[model samples]
Target: MGLLDSLEGMAASAMTNSGSDQAKVAGGLMQALQEHPEGVQAILNGFQNNGMAGHVEQWASGALQTATPEQVQTGLGGTGLIEATAEKAGVSPQMAQTILATVMPMVISHFAPNGQAPEQSQFSGLAGQLLQKFL
Candidate 1:
């Protein structure tokens, strides 16, 4: 399968395996990533800047680690990602932060299947697909 197909499949699988709330958070995250000029890189940068480099490294190594809501806030706070996600998902910011603690790891794992972060170019089409599938 192609890269887009793989991303789409991963997103579809995530929605199928998760609760409705999680699906909404995932869609919201996708939308947020799409809107960000830096795309997935922004997420990586946010985590790294917030002293969550270890977590990002773990995810890039193909491990799924849980992040706390506070970690999410610290990492993504100023980026408007969390707020945008909450708005798009129709959830409170706190709820979005909680769910994103799970969804973010899954997203990183999907993009880092080979134990490395994906190129920004690779994610250019993913948000639209995820939004279509889950939103």
Candidate 2:
């Protein structure tokens, strides 16, 4: 399995052993990250590698809090992804956020139920497609 799928599998196991709200959120967040291949790949070997579960256990499971809505928006707003999208599509930041907001839910759902992660091929296609949508 790919890093993405492996992360989701770990998250699925984490969910079964969830001990707190934070743990659940972390588990879900991990799944979501895995499902979003681009995001996961960005940090695949960065920090959330073979030790992701430990990071979650040490931080997210307790001290690691999930990001707020503002944080999520700000993160997307600050990323090169937004500018690239806007430039390609010739749309404003506001429009970009609107599109991202709509797509965010789908990304979440992609990791739903069993916390299944998406395929890298799918993610590659999606990442390019999402960027293209703005273009």
Question: Model 2, 1-135: lDDT tens per residue?
Answer: 665555555545544554443333344444444443365433322223433433223332234344333433554543345444444334454554455444443333342212333455565334333222222
- Tens-place lDDT digits, model 1, residues 1-135: 664455445555555566588787786676666667876778878888888878877877767778899989988988899998888667899999999998777777676554355675667454544445443
All candidates' lDDT scores? 0.72, 0.41
Q: Which stretches of model 1 miss by more than 4 angstroms?
A: 1-19, 113-117, 124-135
Cα lDDT over the full model 1: 0.72
| Structure candidate 2, residue pairs in collision | 59-64, 88-135, 89-134, 89-135
**Cα-lDDT of candidate 2:** 0.41
What's the number of clashes in each of the models?
0, 4
What TM-score does each of the candidates earn?
0.74, 0.35
- Model 1: how far is 104 from its true place, Å? 1.2
